[model samples]
Target chain A: MELYIGGISQGKLTYVCNKKNISKDSDLICDGAGCTMEELLSKPFVNHFHLFIGRLLKEGGAIVTDGAIAPDGPKTDSDRHFLLKPGHAPDPEKIANVLAKDLIAENPSVVIICNEVGCGIVPVDRTDRLYRETVGRCLCRLAEYSQVVERIVCGLGMRLK
Target chain B: MIILITGGSGSGKSEYAENLAVKLGKRDLLYIATMIPRDGESMQRVARHQKRRKSEGFHTLECHTDLKRLPVHGFPTVLLECMSNLLANEMFSEEGIIKTRGNIPVVEEILEGIAYLDRLCEHVIIVSNEVFSDNGSPYAETAGYIKLLGEINCRIAGLASCVYEVVCGIPVCQKGSGIL
Candidate 1:
């Protein structure tokens, strides 16, 4: 497995395409924003891998968005860990761990392009918090299983492993 | 020697910094904690960090804001837990209002605090967050905070003898010969 990670719009996908000698519009590249789990496993490359984790969390009912935040919410830490529906949702962290294991077992040679999302301020919404934390855990597992890992910055790739 | 360590949360930056501090220090080790526990979650975080360094013989000083005024007893190595919390504490006062003078003063105050630590300690290890990467539509004040932190990190990196961005428990040296 190969992993490429960086901030949003840091040119990770472009760097990967150039290095792998793959066209930008190749059918083998699957976008995590819309692709299914089966497609992800079968595809050679996955972009926006963080979104995939969010989708998974949403599907698993770990993300509850209704009545969570006001349209323009008051920016305060009061809502930091306030669950919208307590004891009614599946644990996102466990789901994320299982998904990570599945991905490593199902597709060991896939190339992943994920945005680094855990660096920002802690989100007031519960869903956002779970999404970022799950993404971080998922990427850590993937990076460990990856044969090579690279961090892209300003369209430049820095080999990490 | 000033070493700036930065990374996303859960990237193992704290663990890496602690290991480096332990490796560099001889007898005296000081951990300057900047986070103010507001709730259970933050308190848990603080406890977790303390548990990690339980046997390291670290004398921790809780300096949330006004780092410049915090007195240090001059340790061999001083590890400032993080810059993000310290900056937040300075940017937002106890009443939750933004400081009137803007972020320049905050940056200067933090850098001055860092300089004080540098003068007092032989090795000043600083931990900061990589908060600039995430794509969040933040409010104006939040944006200002981000901008301020980015500037502070850059200035510290410039002055740092070594800088490392910890990724997945691995320290990727960005500048200077990091403690190998």
Candidate 2:
């Protein structure tokens, strides 16, 4: 099952799940706040979790960090690491790869939280357009892999599975 | 064979289609319905449709948007109940309005998808509403959307092996050489 946490706002993750009566055992939280990954991992039942911190992290299962940082880190070379900076979109294939790896390795009940950035008029700015397109493609990929999918609107959940 | 049954609002398109589907005596009758209950009236409409389909014993699939994910294979007969709601869904969906620039694509993607259904299924029946007959409304967006629907209807008619326009619960064959 795939739960898509959307909207420009944050902190609705726990509230929405509680409202739906869905347990938080295998939840995978991905958000802009660099701290969400750590918080989710703190839960006793969470088997594995990942975060895409734009900056390099010395530790983590899969590190999607800034490319400008030096290659030397505590992480092994083959530990599903990515270096993508802020204001830049990660490659769809690479994101899909990480998701696939996590699905196989972690094998936890997964929920993904992402920003809803494509509900309005097209942005006149190129960067904004590119970001929206990238996010859209990423969501599509997630949907392809997901057994069930939902989109939250006005804090109400609509199942699109 | 691909057949399209279309009519204006309150013209009983759903009723006619359901009766035809039951008469066909096919178990794999796929009903691709597109309606969201955003208000009391819409909710009532949905309940009414549900009751009608339940009485008819037709298998239904609710697709509010994202027609790209529609299963193309394994169904004997597919009935896409309406296209207007699908268009509205694409209009209001995430990044939908922006992607279409408020103008629904007049190109062949929609037609191509329908053709794909043709190749995948033994029989395909599409249901649509006739919105062009009424010229009273002055809303530019509504008018533009109707024009687009007209274009889409024309295209579907061109490709459809049978085209029937339902008026007052009567089916009138408008195109192709077959009867339904």
The candidate scoring highest on TM-score is 1
- Model 1 error, position A61 (Å): 4.8
Q: Give TM-scores of chain A for all candidates.
A: 0.81, 0.49
Winner by lDDT: 1
The CAPRI quality class of candidate 2 comes to incorrect
Model 1 over residues A30-81: C-alpha lDDT tens digits? 9988887777777989999988777655544222233221212223433322
Could you give candidate 1's per-residue lDDT for residues B27-143 as a string of tens digits?
A: 679899989887555665688789888788888998877776777766889899899888888778672214655536677778988998888779999999988766654598788
- The true-versus-predicted C-alpha distance at residue B149 of model 2, in Å, is 0.4
Clashes of 1: 0
What DockQ does each listed candidate score? 0.29, 0.01
Instruction: Please state the interface RMSD for every predicted structure, separated by commas.
Output: 3.1, 17.6
Score candidate 2 by DockQ: 0.01
